[model samples]
Every structure is written in structure tokens, then in C-alpha cells.
Target: MLFDCIPSHEIPELLHCDWLQSCDDEATVLGLLDIFTSLALESSAPDNSRPGVLAALIKHARVLAEYVQRCGPDAVTTRSFIQWILAKTVAELRMEPGFHNVGLDRWDRLVINQGESVHLPVFVPLKPSEKPSWRMFLTTSNTTQESAVKVAYRAALHTDDLSLQAMALKLLSLQLEDPREPLRTLSLLQMGMQGDIDGFLSTSLSRYLLVEHLSDARSLVQELSDLDNLSGGQSLLYSGVNPCLLWARDVILGHLLAVISGQKRAGNREWERNSSLHRFEFQT
Candidate 1:
């Protein structure tokens, strides 16, 4: 029914092929998602032209979102897939000649909802340099707090640069639990510089403490989170610029002592907490 109004020449064979119907394995599902996302993003029409094409794009995005929601976190590839869908949607919305925004907001909601449904962190792209280091914080399996804390501390100390130190501190904060609230506060201040939106947003602070940061960053964070349109040249959040806003050289001693003390919360609103940190209202 989706293709009924669209011209046959503009449609990809994958849309009509039987291959998608038999999607049973994660690989197949990923392939289909890739195809759908590609079609939605790559094939474009002007705002007033080809209404059916835009409709089809929206439909593909919804289907992909629903399928990814059901995949759960155990599906490793789903993380990247969801991020791609989100990035693609955002890209389309940014284009001046692309389809209208009429139906695209739903796709944004769908991808964000899918991310929340499966406890996947909102997948903001990290810079090339930050990716390997960020991955270091992620364990193949859950590691103990003591170990995680130690790893985070080492990461913090690994670099002398303030931004890098701030990034390490952000990673370290995730490992710290309770009582270390003072350190967390200091770390927040360290990362508070106005220039580093992506680094700040990419951290757990934004995902884990969304409401607090929303209040802290004021409308800036909310606007960044909204992704309505790209008035700026390009988004730091998506364009891959990483700089830690919190963490400094002078406070290593204090951080070490405070770290010896102990660090964490879920927040309100769908956008505000990490889904894993708190059970979403829909889950319970």
C-alpha cells in the first residue's frame, strides 16, 4: 500500500523484493534496516514534489524503528543501526531541498523511542580520537564498580590535556556511585565551558542526568536535544568534535581524595534519563 502512489522508477527493488519478508537473523534484519534507511535518506524529492516518496520514507523509518525496538540490547549491531537511522533522519531534516518536515518528526520520536525501549543510550557520534577511548569504558560484560572506578581514574590521568582529562572524568563519573556527589559536582563544573556541546552531551551526564543538565544548560541543551533544524553551519553533536567541558589539572588531588570517598540518578520525561538507569514508565 505504501508504494501505490509513488512512481515505479523511483523505487528500489529491495522495497518490493521478497528478501525482507524472511528476515529471521540479526544480519538479515540489519540488511533490511540498511536498505530502508538508505532509501529513506538517499532518495529525495522537493517539498512539494512526490508526496508518496516522502510517505514511503516515513513508513520505512517507522518499520525500522519498530523492528529495532524488538531486537533488544543483546543485538550488538542494533546500536549502530539505530544511530544511523537517527542520523539519517536528522540529515534529511537539515537539507534545504529535501522533503518537508511534515512527517519527519514522527521518525525522530520513533528512533528516540526505540533507543529508550531497548535501553540503548542515545547514539551521539563521538570523534575519531574519542571513539577508541570511549570504547575503553565499555566492557564486554559488566565489570565491578571498584574495577570500573580504577579504570576511569587511570583514563583520567592518561592525558594531561584538560579536555581529555574532562572526558576521562566523565567516564570515571559513570563508575562512581553515591557519596562522591561533590566530585561529580566538580566534574560538572569542569565540563561547563560553553564551547564543548558534543563532548558534554555525549557524556553520561546528558543521557544519565538529562533533567539536571536540561536545567543547567537551560534551553541550549533542550534545543540541542530537539534536533529541529540546523541553523548552525553543522552540529558539533553530529559533526564529530570532542572536547571535555569538565575536569581540570589543579583538582587531581581533590578528585583522588573524593574518589576515595565514593558517585548517581534517573530523571523525569522520556528524554531525560538513560533507559537502563531507570525503568521507563512503559516498561512497568
Candidate 2:
């Protein structure tokens, strides 16, 4: 058995070695991947044991993925392992809120006065058919406070699907726990508004827009409060006019109106051109 070959103490080191080759079979490699995944899940049995064990399991899965890619006996197994790695990584990251610390990139520079002066690498946007798992993996480092921006930028580089990119941008807006970037947030909202993007309101998006669109959000909140008073909380037929959603609609409408009124944003020639009222109406 694979266990007989590796002791518990050596498991950490096993992650760094090409040990999967010892299995000498694709089925065995896949079996080990499954067992490791199960073990990773089992680590969540207790809340206290979660962080360290879960981190280790993610690392282990990554290493196993590498091993399979390099040493798997067949192409099918290698491809399957690659897909599994992507899906498993995404699932774990989504489920384990605490695991946000995983996949963060290390910040190597020091910024005394941070702004646009900071030098950052820019990657080309990916095609719609492409999988951005690797770029997403690279964006996981939290060493810098701008990790959310890094992730958002990666998603922005994706021009293939408006809805998925919008979702990623929404998640980025939510994950930013520090000082907010209104420009970035507004740009994401505008992207979603101008395209075929449609989804429920994101709390982060609603909150940020509420703060920015103070008067609008406030009026909507007051209106909803009035509705609640009138119906005594029995109004289930407002037809999606909840406070959060109303805020999102107001924000999108405000931007769309701005574009229509020929309020051209500086250096946004493409946006101005693409955001014609006809195009906007068609998309809406």
C-alpha cells in the first residue's frame, strides 16, 4: 500500500517529492488523490483543527496534482487530475471562508506613498474559452493588501463571459475588508450594467453603492420602510423591490443615465463608444 511506503512524519516532505511515480499506475495515482481529498475533508471534523490541517491538505493536493501531471502513466489520467485540481481548489476556496489565506501572492516591495505610482505586472485578458485557474491561483497571495485588486484585475482581464467576470468582480468587492476603492467598484458595476450580466444583489456591492449613492439608497430604504409599515411585513409581492436590490438598480441606472447624457468619462473613449444609448437599451 502507499501508506506502508510513507510514514506520517514524512507526509510533509512527501509533498515536495515525486513520490507518485512509486505507485507506477494511473489508477493508484487517482486513488491517492481521492484519499488525500477525503483526508483533507476529514480534517474539518473539529473547528480548531481546521486551519493548519486544511492548509496542509491544500498544499498536499497541489503537490499530488503536480506529481500526476509529471508522472501519471497515461494522458487521460493526467488531464483528469488537472481538471480535478482546478475544481477541487475552487470548491475548497469557496466553502472554507477561513481558507482565503491560501493562494495569496507574496508582496516583495515596500510602498511608502502608495497610489498609481506603484509598479504592477499586467497580464493580458484571457479568452472566453480559456480557464483562468492558474492566474486565479497566482492571485491568491495575501502578502499585499491589494490582493483583492489583484484578483479583480485578473478577472477583468477576462473578456470572454460578462456574467462570470461580473460575479468575480462582485466577490472581489465583497472580499475587500480595508479601505474601499470606489473607482474600481464602480467600474465593475458599470461593466455588469452595460452587458448581459444579471444576478441577485451582492451585499458588498449594495453597501458600497449605498454609501456612495447616499440620497438614492436612503430614499429607497425609506420607501421600503413605508411599505413594511403599510403591509406589516406581510408583503411578499413587491416583485423584487427589496432595499438591497433597489440600491443596486439605482446605482446601475445612475451610471447608465450618466453615459446617455453624454457625460464622457476621461480616458474612457472605448466605454463612451460602446455605451451608446441604443447598445445600452439592447443589453438591458
Candidate 3:
């Protein structure tokens, strides 16, 4: 295969090849994806090669997704491809040196700063004004983060694979942990409005409490209250007789109260346990 003839270190450059972009054969695309996946797992590759390989996989995954979507939505191949991208991204994040210590903020900044040097165009925005300085690459328009999250969210909603669902949740949780405004809040509200109330509440509340983001938590509570009122209390949580709005509201309010009471609580500890179980060691 042509991929076999290319050195692992130069795999990222293949994305720029005109022929590869023009190729429309699904078998060929899947074959290339499998080869890249295998290469990504080769630990013998120099540490310096990891970032480029990761970026290449992300870029190719986006290309493959667009191609797959043109064929049809929610196909088995689409789910499998999305799963592969998420799994590969998660694996790369795990292997990143000092990923745990540097924190997502620093790591995100590093990616943005080093993006140009590493030829990671995926991190760059199409329009400069679309992303202001305060926003992270993950929330930027048309970047790898947006594409990955969209596909993963779709896969999460459609796939019965428990592990894939977990991966999707983890990816969403990671994004939610970003301290940026508007985008973060918008993502949370979107999840809730889309009927993933459990995910919306658990991910946002747990992450906010874990980091002691009192203001954000309060804002979220207010947002939920307004949403419930706007829906005339017939929101997704409506349980035939009564809406679970009170239950959800109380759950968040209880966390806030616990934080306010000066009593050491278990939310952070529980979040830590769940995070560790998912192998995500991100520190706020």
C-alpha cells in the first residue's frame, strides 16, 4: 500500500495529497484509516512524532466524516469511524506527557501556540474574528474539537455501545470543563434542550462543583429555571404527572448549599472517582 511506503513521521503530510482528497472509494478510505490507526498505536515512534500523528488522525477523521455523511447518516460505518476517532483522540490525550499536570487550559494554549510550528492547521480558525483571544481552540469554529464533539455526540445518541457512549460523555465533559463563557453555557443548554437532561446536569454540575465554579453554577441554575418557565414546565423532564424540574433544580441547589455550608462534601470526591474510572486526569 502507498501508506506502507511512507515513513510514520511523514504520515501527516499525506493529508495534503491531491489524489487522496479526490479518492472516493469507501474501502480505500477505511483501509487508510485502519493503517493510520495501527501506526498511531506504535509506541516505538519518537515522542516528537506523537503530536503530528494525532493531528493527522484528527484531520483525516474530519475528512472521512464529511465523506461518510454524504453517503448517509447514522450508518454503521459512520458510527465505527466516529468511535475510532474518539478512541484515538482519547488515547493520544492519555499518552501526552504532563497532560495531567499541565491542565487543559495550559495544554490548550500550548496546542494553539505550537499549532503553526507543528503544521496543525486544524487548530487555526477560518475567520480570525470567529474566535477571540479568550476562547480556546476546542470551542473555535470548524476546528477538530467542534467536529469531534459533533460526531461523538451523534454517535452517543445513536449507538448502543456502552463504551462508545462513555467516550462521548468523557469528550463532552472535557469540553465542559473549559472555563470560557457563552460557548460553554450554550453547549450545556443545548444538551438539556436536546433531551440529554441527565448528561447536561451531571456533567455541568459535577465539573462546576469539582472546580468550585460557584458563579457558573449559579448561572446554570438560573438558566435552567428560565428554561423550565419558558417551556411552561413541560420540558423534557416532564414525568407524566409532574416535571422533574424540581428534582433537577433541587439537586443543583443542594450542591450549591453544600458548598456554601463550609462542610466538606463528596461531590468533588465522587467526581474524582468517576474521572479516574474514565482515565481522565484533567485538573481544573
Candidate 4:
């Protein structure tokens, strides 16, 4: 049904073609996603376009996202079959122009997880001097106090530069050192964060604490377990920039300290005063 809408030539190449099953390169995948998304939209037009391709591409995209994220690809060759399909989609299709590669952001993450930043080059045409990308290489794997502390300070201890990541990590480590309170660190970090949109804050923090870093991360549990006089807003605000906000060498020293020492939770939403730390409800 998807083929009926396209110019005669475009249909056979895409349909008769097992294009979706054949890609393994990053660029090819982006090219394919863009090409397929376009084809799907075109084919779905009221006049003659096949609506099926739109559904098909969305399906392909999910599969593509999985393949990129969890691929078992061998080194020195195709990383994913998705890459091959992409190459097929692009090489032969009559495609709409100007589709900038949005999928690159998705794939670049895959590259980062594998400790491989090289894949970034294929998606964006980078300058020759761009340093090989790196992320917070860490201390250990579990949530043992030591590991938790490591997770909090993961970025500052590792990478260079005052990237938002460093600001966050530095603040969190300060928390570790000052478990009695986080106000000073919060004050320091607040000054550094310019126009604090949620995306910018979340992304900066996330890039530093990636899923890989968290391991068995239940941050909400941690936060609920140990909040103090400063207000959850202050605690989370500080943590957003760095893990050291409660600088406990482990949960017991830092967290238990907070549990026993935490200021009384006010009758109402006092913590919600700061927009950043107060949004997620504390559903006790």
C-alpha cells in the first residue's frame, strides 16, 4: 500500500528493496531515517500516497533506535544492520532535500556508551581539531557508599574544563564534604548557572550522570531519605550541578547524617519554592 503514492520509480526501489534490514553505519542510518520519514509523509498524502510507509517507517525507527542503543555489532565492521538499511534507503531513493540529521543526537549517545566517540564524526562534519569526546569514567559499579560518592563526584574527578558537568560534579562533592548542609555549594553553583531552563539544567546534569553512571539509581529514594533544613529545592538544585551535594563517603555517613539531622518538613510546599527541585511530587 505504501508504494501506490510515490512516483513509479521510487516505489519499487524502496518496496522490492529490503532496505530496512540492511544498514550498519551511523550516517547511513540518519540518511535512511530522514529518507524514510519523508517517503512516509509523501506516500500518505490524500491523493495517491500509501499510508502504510508512514507506519512502516515509525516501526523501522523504533527498531533502529534499539539497534543503535543496544547493538551487538562486532568491532571493525558493521555496528548494526540498521546501518545497511539506511545505506539502501539513501542510495537509491528520490528523497526530499534539507532533512538535517536529527537521529545523530540519538546515535551519538550509543557511541558514548560504548566509550566510542568516533561515531560522532560521521553524523556531524566536525573540525579537524575537535578532541575525541569523553565522558565521566568512574570509580565503581554499585551503590555502596563509596560508589555513591564516586557517582556524585564522577565528573569533577574525571574530565577537565568547566563544562556544566564540572560545575555539577564539583557542587555535589562539596555536598559530600558538608553533609550538615548544602547551602554554600548551592549558592556557589547558582551563580554559575546562567539562564536556567529545565532542558539546559537536565541535559547538563544528565550528560554527567548518564544512565551508565547511576547503576541502580533511585535518586528520588535517596532524596526522600535524606533532605534537610535547606529545602528539597536547595538540595536538588545543588545536586543538579554536581553529585557531591551531600559528600558522604558512603550513604550512611552522609545520608544517615541527614536523616537524623534533617530540618522538619513544613506543613505545606515550602520546598517547591525553587522551580528546579520542587516539580516532582514527593508521593509518600
Best by the lDDT measure: 3
What lDDT score goes with residue 67 in model 1?
69
Compose the digit string of candidate 1's lDDT tens values, residues 1-284.
88778675446444635566665566676676666655544343322244455456556556655666687854423433533433243233334332222433322221122111111123221111111122222212124433433443344344333433343343334333332353344335454543444434333333332222224334433433443232276643245433121111111112222223331111122223233333333210
Off by over 4 Å in 2: 1-57, 64-145, 148-152, 159-164, 174-199, 204-216, 219-284
lDDT of 3 by residue, 1-284 (tens): 77898875466556535547788577656655555443443421323446566556556655655565566654434545666566455545545553332223423111112111111101211211121222221211224654675576666566544434544554554444343442354344446444544434433433332333557556655654554454466644443312222333344454454554554442444333333444422222
Against the reference, the lDDT scores of all candidates come to 0.36, 0.38, 0.44, 0.32
Going through the candidates in the order shown, the clash numbers are 8, 7, 0, 27
Which residue pairs show backbone clashes in model 2?
A: 103-140, 103-141, 104-140, 104-141, 104-142, 105-140, 105-141
Residue pairs with backbone overlap in model 3: none
**Mind giving the per-residue lDDT tens digits that candidate 4 earns over 1-284?**
76567765445346424664575576655455555544443343322234344445545654554555453443112322322232222222213222122333422121111111001111111111121221321111222432333333333324322232333333233224222123233323433444322223322232222212232134423432444333445654454532222221122222223333443222222222321333332111
Model 4 residue runs over 4 Å out of place are 1-30, 33-58, 61-264, 267-269, 276-284
Off by over 4 Å in 1: 1-6, 9-17, 45-48, 74-80, 87-284
Winning model by TM-score? 3
lDDT of 4 at 283: 17
- By TM-score, rank the candidates, best first: 3, 2, 1, 4
Estimate the lDDT of model 1: 0.36
Window of ten residues with lowest summed lDDT in model 4: 116-125
